[model samples]
Target: MRRLFTGLAAGFLLLGTAACGSSDGSGASDAGAASGGTTTLKVGVIPILDVAPVYLGQKQGFYAKRGLKLQLIPAQGGAAIVPGVVSGQFQFGFSNTTSLLVAQSKKLPVKAVANGVASTAEDGADFAGITVKKGSPLTSPKQLAGKKVAVNTLNNICDTSIRESVRKDGGDASKVEFVEMPFDQMPAALAGGQVDAACTPEPALATVKAAGGKSIASNFFDVSPDLTVAMYFTSQQYAQKNPELVKRFQEATIESLKYADSHPDEVREILTTYTKIPDTLLGRLTLPRWPAEPDRASIERLARLAQQDGLFKQSPDLDKLLP
Candidate 1:
């Protein structure tokens, strides 16, 4: 989706670097030491609530103080974003952990350099989880077998962690049917009985709950209390070529994550900039944990679950994939 790039570009004014990220020979995404020696890098990102911290961080001048800035190009999935980073069109990319692991499994040279977002670790109180209609008979994840469940992306973080929740609850995860749809559509889909359940995050989750939907399981929390759902990544080639740049990005991003975690009001306010989430839903929504470090234990657990689910052609090498 080249149009994803153009649409995302049109949504926000280009500011500065894709920082915490990369470099390639052509360096088309790079500004080549502009802004009084500050480098601007283009980052491939999805325009969603999960990415608010980076925007907030940029506005807070965390990146600027580090001589970095962001140019976030929008794309819907890892399929497009990963390739963009590999091709040097985007110096960095933001994606869920599973996509990066799957890329590693397939021998793609993607490397995770910074933490993204995480689960609240509290069942029924998490930002994202498996939800059911208020009056539905399904009260637990174990009852989810042979039922329709919606997720924004199938076979990625949503379904993978959901399966873990199912298995933990003594259900046959493979028998659970995953229906793919956007998070915004899930509230109506659940209320209308179009899907039995949905693995959704806020603000859509907030919408669903307000409409009498009940979260049956904290899937991400079930996987690990510190489940690192998403991350900011770059190509291995770029990391090797420019370790210092990557390090700066990593440090700045962790600082940003810490800042964002502590400043919920600012984070909530920043969500209005890139996304069209309603103020009413925004206040009710659960904010996810934006940790300063990627939980390696949780990631390893994710890799194991992915392997069990046959997501890998071969086992992913965590040593290479994570920084």
Candidate 2:
């Protein structure tokens, strides 16, 4: 967990400027040189169901057809990926809306390129949920107050959305204690009573559910039925310098998102390629909505909720942030 914060801090320190590592206008890694003949771009991604589309797209040759290749690096969360993208360690990254908003508030030179994922918007049936052990007495989001809740990262999307759920249930969100744990570790932690609850997304959500965990609320749904949970992004410098490559990436990604949205079985099969999610759970896990573009209204609503929760130091400028 220390690596999560350390890597982000290092990213900020390593890249004093957006053009720190690059010397020319191609805005590519040294490995992506002409010597290789194929432009392979590194992208930092989280190991979650939300990122399944890009993998599917890659397998489907969307990026290859665009004369690009992806080297997806599994990151703990946006804490690392944000800085990785900004520092040029990754040409692109996947991050939640609030974390991107928080990065924007800090004046980080980053911009979202395409929609990553969204909520199913079905009450108690969304892709991610706030879950407690089945035998636990807690049956509502309001009960999260005065209890410890585990989130992948603190002050980012997981906690921010959970706070909204608690507040919507008429509970004081501030009273909730958020414990920082990786998504993979959450199932065991919740089962062992290491935390009172967890904000889990599939297939971890599926694992917890298989363990008899009962979801009390759909946090993303509680925030907004149209909430744009996450998106694919790149450093502003990378976007500015590599306009053509970025355009190719955007086109490929949007196609990938659309393809994944319509093909559920392919997505389940692709999960086996990068993650260790079991076959039995794959059939039961709820997949997120993959919209070709983000919902600006939902993002705006999240910005307002982030403000209410004190996650941002300054207002998020959507015009410059969104694609």
**Best-fitting candidate, scored by lDDT:** 2
Q: Each model's RMSD to truth, in Å?
A: 5.8, 3.2
Clashing pairs in 2: none
Give lDDT for model 2.
0.86
Estimate every model's Cα lDDT from 0 to 1: 0.80, 0.86
Q: Tell me how candidate 1 scores on lDDT.
A: 0.80
Best by TM-score: 2
Return the TM-score for each candidate structure.
0.86, 0.93
How many Å off is the CA of 183 in candidate 2?
0.5
lDDT of 2 by residue, 95-152 (tens): 9888899888878888999999999979889999998876988999988999999998
